[model samples]
Target: MVQPVSTLNHPTLLESPQEWDLSTLYQGFDDPQLTGDLEQLQQTAIQFRDTFRDNIKDLTAEQIADCLKQLEAIAQQSGILYAFPALIFSADTRNTEAKQMQDKVLEALTSIENQLLFFDLELKNLDDARYAELEQSAVLQSYRHYFYNLSKFRPYKLSEAVEQTRNQDSLTGRQAFINLRSVHLGEQEYEPVSTPDGKSCSTEAELGALLFHPNAEVRYNAYGSVRSVMQQHNSLYGYILNSVAQDHKLENQMRGYDSTLHKQLLADEVSEPVFRAIMSGTRDRFDLWQRYYTLKGQALGQTIRTCDVYAPWDSQPVEPLPYKAGVETLLAAIADFDVNYARRAEEFFLKNWVDAKVRPGKRGGAFCWYIHGKHSCLLLSYTEDYNSLFTLAHEMGHGLHFAWISDRQSYFNSNPPMILAEIASTFNELLLLDYLLKQAGDNPALKKTLITRQLEDQLNLLFRQSTISRLELAMHDRATQGTFDHTFVNDQWMSLYHELCGDAVEVLPDHQYDWARIGHIYFKPYYCYQYTASNIVSLACYQKYLQVGKDFIPGYLELLSAGGSMDQVTALKQYVDVDLEDPATISAALKYVEGLLDQLQATL
Candidate 1:
């Protein structure tokens, strides 16, 4: 459902280069500096291991702080070394040199990590009393959360030798399967479909854009073509998926995790009870999802099929918003909210940190990759529509979040957990929504489009993502027991799809192959639920901002600046007065969705 809106035909916009400049990291794969950095990173790792391999338990608080600072420097070096080739590979998956460099970097980094694994392992092995004393010392005050988070994994720590073995094996074990999925998808050729503009799509991203086309036949054919490719290769994708799941299953057991979900929640710094609450809360509100789609069906004067979910509400062709116009509008929205945020966001454009050009061999979807102690880079294929505009705002929100973290926190504390990662991005989207709605003014058609778009986003984020999470749980359960084939996954996906859609939307046959297309399931397990949880939290935070007005900016900024220095639950409660543990918090967000549905219904 996340696709570009329309193709930009403006000469001025088209003339501007939309690629990101990576000279800030390195000039090229063959750059001499890239090799120098790798050599230095390996040396640093050796020095770190030789200095602190078995001495962590005996070190004083000040000595521990010094050790951490050294590790932080090493991490920054390794980040640059890995990020360079990885970014190049992302820009063009088919680039053989880039892919080779990526693999080489990964092998080297894995060895480096293996050398440095003893520091955390020994730290986690420290006695509880001594650990508490060092954690509370003034010398280690800045790293108190770092120590606390490390200790949470104490029960999951394996022997240093075993840990090192796993790190080395992942090159050909778990990580290899993940890479296979990426390369396979990148090489896939979807059958081209006809569009109203006589446009044809060769890549999955281009085909995805057609799903939002005004013509129903175009949407249907695009959907069918995408699934047909997945169906043709379902066996390979299924094997990759099973391999990843089996790896997770074995590792979970080895780490003493009660369930695969437990291990994922631990990494997110979220409690199992809180995760269950979010899932239950989302599942309880299936009616809202059904009601919205039912109304969409009425508006279209036809039963909403699976492919019609993203169909345009208006049959008239939409004027493409030029890329420059989209940028200006996004900046204006941030400026209207706060001038400081707008100023920081402008740097992404000014510094050439964004790659928005659409081209073959480039990966599908958008992501913002942040290098600690440096800036973030965004990648997206821009087609000059409202969806692309919102995607721009979302990824920039991530860039701004990382900007604050890089400015305020150490590298050790800069990476926020996945659960909190989506907060700023989703918050930015809501702000843009409000700005565009107000700008619509007396234009009822524009207002309806904006409103319906927001509703669709909420549906995708809340209901659809939660359903994916459910499928993940089921998949992991089967993996824990024995094994499951593509057919098992297909049936489970359809079952969950039917549960979510109920009698409102028609569940198509091609929808069964849809599970193969979700890259996250094969890449990061349990990542989908974070989208659901973050959406709920973002809605609550946005509502609070409306109530508090200007008073809310400082605490919100502080939340972003805090990064991983504090647990997300405490950060949310302290900064925005939103409690994730409370059922009422979930109810409030669902109420807001209902209010939006009511507004759209009134328009109908």
Candidate 2:
């Protein structure tokens, strides 16, 4: 059974690498050279603000470019300082010192932000002819991508006074309420759930474990415990939802965003039609998922409920895999896609790029962070399960992608949008699945089960997340219209969820409150659709690579390295020719899933 979230800090947690060998960034955060560089940048920022904030219009293109370069350097240093321990804290929320370090760096960053608030404002003021000339200027040419991004936001840019007002208000506005929600939501207590052996389990941990449990009762009881806790706190969650929705309403209207979906689409550099295509195509695949669940319920001899959705195909407990074998297996699987991808992942593992151990006060979940100009840091809880192996491969994919980009782009242009961020990781998962399936060769039952599980993975990443995105959009729209309250959110959530699960599994009444526990809803509204988008793209690309053999691997590498320097859709097209707006792409994925379900039924 999964342990309590708090147990992440147990003394038995893995020891993190002390150095993590980040010579690629700076020798150390406190190294004399880096310290000297940081101090110089800080002073330069001060000088630039003092010298040019009031008279930047008269500056030459060379002067503006030189100042921007200095600002980029300073921002890079701050990001490097923030990445390591921030990652450590994410791996274990209980780490007091790491948390403190994050706070200190955040405060320092705010100071730096205030110092350079005038840079963009002043740069935008240049006359059209001068701006065009600057675009071709030798110094400014290096920053073409950055300059283009700024130009895109020109229409959305407010007057300097109004911009400053919104910037300050941001701290106490919708963002603040979201942060406030995290504190209370993260600490909410669910009742202890009982494992198959009748041992008490942590609510958070139990839910995770139950999802993979072979025993139907275990999954049911665990889910019951989770729902009980959520229902108990329903009223409190309602108030937070109302407050945040009202805040979004006020701000979205003030900012002139056409609709709730428009904000996310704009941020993702895509359009509503693209997102709608994904959602609609995936939603239409619910019958395939339902058929699979029907077979699953029949195999288990139980009435399939929400909890039963995660029961393992085999009733036997999976033996724990050794760490080295797990790592080797994943690397080999990824190698099938591109040898260099596997090698890069191996380098990170060997170089202590991963913080895999669970520790006290460490946070739950997994992530990969590209620490400025230095190196990537990965944080995850490794239990040696198949799930953990997939997670390791996923995050390693993120690291390898970032490594490629860091080798290619300047600090200012290396960031990819969150919508496209999952593509690399999910791509790794598909490769791993291919590897595992190949090894399972003649073991029919095992092969079938593996395929079934992969189908479940697709369902969650695509179909289920689409449900979340729709719910988020509905909530945001209603809230913006000042019509959303607790009841409204609960009802909308249930309706959307039912559409995904179909008639095969029963969702308990209390399950409607499940949205309250989803932190992503609080962090980035309508962001969950990215999982669906990325999975569809990953599958489409993996299919092409498999078809074309080694020739396509080079193109795949180019896509990874291109990063944000190119538009996400363009990079995706460079590797795979599918258009996201074409419903056929997602329909192809669903058809594949339906074929798997048919195979399972035929075997039965």
Candidate 3:
């Protein structure tokens, strides 16, 4: 067995890059506690169903309060059980033990989740008067968002048999195609970097990093290798995409949802108009993306390709920052915002809450995962670039949000939705960017570099993400209309490219397969819009922070603490001034991106 990444000795957790300590989650897959917890969870679920499934609608307010407690207890246990193995597997997919443990967890979870499915459906079926009566009780006030959101599906509830069958098919159905895509993309290695000791082929993320490489030849070779590999498998990837898209379409149709995007908006607790407004607002700012790309090409003193868009301006060799230095940088910046936010962030490192090392088999990209009513875990592959530091801040931002709010809210409402979740992470990124800019001071050279990168983040977080969402909308719409195959998918994907970048940058032929490259469409359709939504709102939040300084911290903290206890739009209205429903909110966000572009241009 691959030994667990050795736990750290120094408090820094970075003298050597630390892997997360999962002992708190479980001792091992074979730890009898794994089985014991599963059994206990299963028992609780069965007991819950047996006691409440038939009588949920009739439970008095006090009884309903108790019912929620039992359900929350059951859910909290199951959440931990599901998260551990799933996380372990991502760290090392090659581990047979990890794989088998994850499968076991999935099997147990499916069974438990199946048993508990009756709770929500039956709860939703309660008469309006009953649900209102339960919600109005002072005892139930804390859970108001939980039950109200639960009852949201009253209009769309399917028969128990249909829902159960759908859950059963989930593993083998669209999920299988998603898994296939994951394995296929993860396994393919690209040509090595020109640096000494570089291997003959690189991991997918290593290839992605090359897009930022200063050596133009190395970047182009890596870019070509990526393109060639993607093209080689593009057809099969296309097949997988079509299969999953078809599966999603079939599910949406069966459920009577208005559209595919509509389904996701509902889950995010956002309305369709809000989603489209963010999307359209971003679309109207494609010129900002074009300006950034054109300016980047000028800085590079060469024609810009899709690959070169992320290339940093200065060609000087950037010495990799020590991981500890990166942490200090982020912590100091966060401290400038709010001491508690910084303190909460420091705990991730001091307590060994992060797995920030890069190794073969660990997942690509960075993510923050929640541990029910406890703290959180952050996983990332840290390089020494400013981008790496930004990623560190980005995830710790999430860790801090989850870490703090775990105490503020109950199990039922503690887990925030995507709409609000992105705000914390993206907001932290803004904090980091602001910190970097201030540190640059009057040094134009440093200022130019940091500003360019900051703008690049906006392009990435705001514009590129929304473009992907637009492509998703078209692809899903076509799927609903009739036949959709790989070719039609490719054409639509490329069409969005032409529209998004115009004549500013080359789209290249193989970029058509980008839809397949995105795992989100497979896992959570139309989810990309949230990044745009969150980034724009985050810009608004940052602007407010600038205006009110420390006064803004309380509201921002309140925003995070509210978690998923309220629908996202309502949460924003209650805590912050931004409104997702207003096109003007998005318009203001675009102006922020435009301002960044203008700064970059002024530097040029």
Candidate 4:
């Protein structure tokens, strides 16, 4: 039997320390300059396309450089084009104007993209030796990385009309399905979960916190409420997931991709064997996950249910950390290794570069949106819990990466590859954790809690994602063959959980529709494993930091500043001294996890 929750009220949530000032991007939806910028992009794109469409191959290298400059000018302003409406919708999804503007932006950009499509297509068609000469010229040297990477897709190139068809249909294809999923989720309002205190929560963020509630009964109730809500919409979500996967399947066949994951690997610029190396290392360490979960079960004095996996293994929950305190803590932690990181982090908060408010109709999770090619703005729905604070730091980490790389790399190489995108964010999280642990000093209970956090994050990032990658691979392969359904997803997902997480936790029935809720897989197929890859890579970076201290700072920062100047594997091997292809690197990272388990076991 569960202990009765107290029949009394508790503090709900603290006010957000600050709301983001989006003026850094633009003043608002109606800013006159917003219209001016969009018109400017249209004028620029048209002029460039008309000037270069028939003569890209015949143009001098200097002329090509001028064309690129005009193109980048249009590209830079696109931040306001998409980011403005996205910010509006994220804050208030019910706003019809915002929704209309989002549609408007997509349509407008599609036209501009359609106009610019010939540039790359025509360039790729240039005689191989001629293209080489162009790529090596002084004017094109900075864009060398861009042209070289673009060439890899030449084998998969289609006619300009076909490419335009693909681009146009995309608005109605997988992207539309993803939008439907987001709307479906955002529309849901879970029925309130009754508490022993007679209080209740129905919001996604609030109920999510209850999953880690100090009281097991509260956690169970919250979990039941969530599962019940998800069950009502399971078929809708299932349809969404199925349709999205099938979209990728059709495209995969069209493109002759090796498999669904092969395209992602190509985009990520990593090889299949290297990708499998991550999976293999995590697969070999099932014992470690089992041990950790078993210990957590022991701590809970009962079988660990899926709901209890993230439950705190402590005497009681820690007090919610304030937003201001969270910001200060993260800044101080980062200051030790790189004072500049702290400065960038401060700029995010100080310059109105973050949206930290939490309210109805706002998106559920945190994200860092890179504005233009210059800097990133963060969107966060901050709760008082430390985990939420970690979310803040995580997004800020992405902001710092964008800020650091902005001045160093041209727009062509400005964005980091998806595989390395999470590294800086995860790195920030590790440093924040370490700083918090040190701040705990001689408090054994606090240390245990910190260790528990470390384990949970590692298990999810390093292990669970690898397992999810298997499910994604299976789903895409099956979707290609046909007749895959919700039941099929449940079976495939459960098999992965059992194999990766073991029987240390019970898999409840409602958890079967898990695939329905994942936005990443739906948005970008075979995209889930980067979390696993990045976690292992970040852990290895942290290990080096411990061994070399501040001396390691320059190399790590350089890696971030390098952006997409080099592929992920080369960057890691050169800067962090770890190779994705090296199984030992994964094992070495696992050692840090093992040390945490050892410390937690000692406390027990």
Candidate 5:
């Protein structure tokens, strides 16, 4: 039998670092090396522009490759320069020095980007004969995909002067508004939540964790307290959302894209049909989502509410999974999949590359930030429940993906597109789920909990993410026609929630303003759909692993290793023989969820 949560012992918990060691990036913001690197980056960027500008059309294939190599060096430097302060600022959003340094770095990088903007525009504007000649060059083979992806933007290419103006204007334009949303969220205080112990103050992260509180009233009130803050500042958030959306719409008009979604998918190298396939397939399976929630309510002996969506099935508070235990569990799962994969992941923990502390002013959600040639760092407020454990696994999956890319690819290909980005992370979660389920053995409660968690995770990734993407489509459409306020956004969100939930759960009043808290809508517009797309891909990949066993390892690693070096669809097909373009592929992913739902029902 699996050990009880309360009795599971991990001695290393005492020695594990709570805060990440930023020393890997720099000693601190005050480190002279940080300053010197910024200076060096500026000098290198200037030299690049002077040498490459107005000369791309005259360069040979070898010269073009040399230019790209220099550009990649500049990009690597800029990645480190930006990542250092950005990671620090994320760790402590209230840190004035870190925030200021981040702003300075962003401004400097934007200026550098403006100076180098002509190179890409010139390449995009190259005559068909010249572009085809370069495309066939053996010397340029390494960067073939890179330039092919760039050429997709030719229709959207503005003149150099116009593009430069837009690039510089963004500091005060859309970007300034995005930063405002971040800073505003980081500063706001949520009302204290009443737990069984007592009434306690909460940060956004703390308040979020309470949604899983074993007590129904606590979950409801915590949800209200979190949303009340958003409702209170709904006007300001509405303005920020509208401003960002308007900026996107204006740019779409200027760049000649049909819509914001079109522009985003182009960058992702994902075709429109595949996007529609996932969204449509997900919407068609709303019944499975509703069925899971109904089963959850039955198991918990209460009507489901939005707040109770994450509540534990048992009425007992779950014992915290200490950071050390979480890391060990995660590593063991990966190691089970392949020892070499586990070895790559061990570096993050050994090198102190993760910040897993819960603190005020830290960012609320989790993210893995990978510096091109250095390493990846993860930031998450670890609340130490099963959710946090899975989150740890998820982000480490991203860290490992970056590690593979860094090991095998050039700096130019290190960053995968957003569509391919979440595959490793979600795949890691599945591995953890499988490991936990196997460990559960004849332990019914443990098995139920693990199965429920997996089902809910799939629901969120496949259904809720697509709902958010649908909302983005609606909001952006409204922006194109005119402007939308919080009221319209709220109504649309509730409508979509009702459509998806289908009376399986109670959609409360406060749930209407939930859109305010979705940072991606304000920051990234149409980015949420990528999670849905990736979840589909990862589920399919996991199924292949099950069927083929260890034989799946090589191709899976190759997919991650390919990084952004190839288009995601091509990589998926060539590596794993998974055709994302097929509607059956998407249906198969939903069927996988249905199979999990069947298991959960059998346990119930």
Candidate 6:
């Protein structure tokens, strides 16, 4: 959930960089240069429309190259402009100035994007000879993927008049429904029940506190609060679901998508076989989690419930990790792989590159935003806990990944697809686990807990999230065929939960509306598959690093720096030689989970 725009009261996350510069985006949002860039981008988009909108169908080789280069430049600067304020606002959503800047830039950028929508349609309309001539050009040849990508959308293209209607509908059609739903859902208050300690909390705070609480009763209270609150507005949620699903149906029919998942998969540039492999392999390992809950239930001296699933196992007496120690620990872990990884991380830490403190009105979760080639900023609430340490390491991985890629590629080529975005960050967590395990040495209990945590990561990415993606596919498929109802969607969602959970533990009756709290469903449909896919790839690469020692660092570094210039599969193949289509990668991850189950059983 986003922090409200009225909550910010300080400058912890938005402070200026001490090492790298972000002035490339603008000296600040208030910078005159920022306004100049906006005006310039608008002018350039108009000039581009005037110069090539009609000429694309008859473009000579040189003219095609010029247009492509200009388009790339426009996109790169536009990204910087949006990136700066969006990142700033994400960290401190209460900053009205930042939010206003974000909205202003987004509105301006949307207009620019709309202006260029015709370029692709027009380019695809060219004769074979004209396209052939353009393709033969060196510049166009280099961007073959980009050109082919635009051509792939020719099937979805409507007539100019219909396209214009879609342009308007895109803002107010499904998107508007989604935005309206967001405003309603985010504002709906969930009451926090009285805890065993007799302390009161807000709904989200109680959930956060429950996950780490030593007492079982607190977890149950948190769960009850969640149910009670969600129940209050169940009908509103149902209405939102129906409206959004109908919106999607309207758009899908207009665009002529073969399947509901087809549009999302096409954008990802991956295949259904690969997605199914991850889902199936993860489902097969459901017993690993069943075993885990069995162990957890034994430790807790009772049956494990939905609320208990999140709390720490047996509440180990680990010390709180201070912010500096967390940063240093992460650096030491990265240092084991390569000096470059460690040095880059240290540079980020020493500079004002991270907003690590928690304050009122600040957003939750951690993210890394790359402002340009030279700089990035991390937003996180640095709680003094083991999980928070891992969070820091995870976001740092993203920051350094951005840096590595931006340095290696042209500005236009630096944006990786969302499917590959999780790789570098997950890789860091793998490295951190390796570092922690080695340090644990003969400490069986600590090692067991770490292994369990690792298995939990698998449970989340592969089993839980992958299952959610499948459910999303089903929901959207039904909606496309005119199936839009609250009860039907809720029933389907609950059925999916049963399949994924698979007797791991007894699911509470009230948990049927679990999908309601999952914001990703409303924002990015079928987006969870990437987490599962990346986990499969990360485990494979991490295992290789363990076996081959220093020999793997060069390949790993190359993978991080490869970025968006190449396809995700091609970039992954450079470091880890596994066919994503093959079931082997998923099987390997499941087998690793199976091994952990054995270790956990022995500890018990």
lDDT of each: 0.87, 0.71, 0.78, 0.79, 0.86, 0.71
Sequence-dependent TM-score of model 3: 0.94
TM-score: model 2 vs. ground truth: 0.88
**1-604, model 4: which lDDT tens digit per residue?**
0111222221321245566667766677788888888888888888888878979889999989888777776777776579888877876666778888888888889888998999999988999998898979998887877887888887777779888888898788878888877767777777677656586788777777788777888888788776776778887777888988887777777877777777778788878887888878788888888999999999889889888888888856677777766666777778866776677677776666777776766777778888755467788777777788788878888988888788687677887887678889999998888888777777777677777987998888888777778888888888878957777888898788877767788887777766666678787866778888888888888888899988898898889988888777889889878777788878877887898889888877
Per-residue lDDT over 1-604 for candidate 2, one digit per residue giving the tens place of the 0 to 100 score: 1111110112321233222345555554455765565566567678868987877778888778778777778788778766755664565455566556555555555556767778787667667777677777887766876776776655555666666666566566765676456545445565666666776766364356566777777777777776777777777777777776676676567767776577667777777788878877877667877887778878887767887787777888665555555676777677666666667777776677777663433455667878867788887766567777788888988898898888887777788766567778988888777788877667766576667778888878877888888888788767755655678878998888777677777887878877877777777777788888888778887788778988877787778777777667766776667566667778777777777677778878
In the range 372-452, model 3's lDDT, one tens digit per residue, is 866788998776567778888888888888876886987888888887898888888888777777765666666776777
- List where candidate 4 sits over 4 angstroms from the true fold: 1-15, 194-199
Residue-pair clashes, model 4: 0
lDDT for position 593 in model 5? 90
> Scored by Cα lDDT, where does model 1 land?
0.87
lDDT of 4: 0.79
- Winner on TM-score between 2 and 4 is 4
Residue-by-residue lDDT tens digits, candidate 6, 1-604: 0111111122232332222245545688778989998999999999898877776766666777777788878888888889888766655556778767876887788788878877777877777677666756786666666665666676787776677667667565666665555445434455665656586766353355455566777777777776665666666666676677676667678889776577777777678777677777777777777777778788777777777776677565455556555565677778777766777777775556777766444554567877654577887776566677777778888888888887776665676766667778888998888788877778776676677778777777777888778778778877766656656766787787776566666677777766766666776667788878877887888888888889887887788777666677877776666456668878888888788778777777
lDDT of 6: 0.71
Which regions of candidate 5 deviate over 4 angstroms? 1-17, 199-201
In Å, residue 569's CA in model 4 sits off its true spot by: 1.9
Worst 10 residues of 5 by lDDT: 1-10
- Candidate 1: pairs in clash: none
Error of 2 at 554 (Å): 0.8
lDDT for predicted candidate 2 compared with the true structure: 0.71
Superposition TM-score, candidate 4 onto the true structure: 0.95
Candidate 1 off by > 4 Å: 1-17
lDDT of 4 at 494: 78
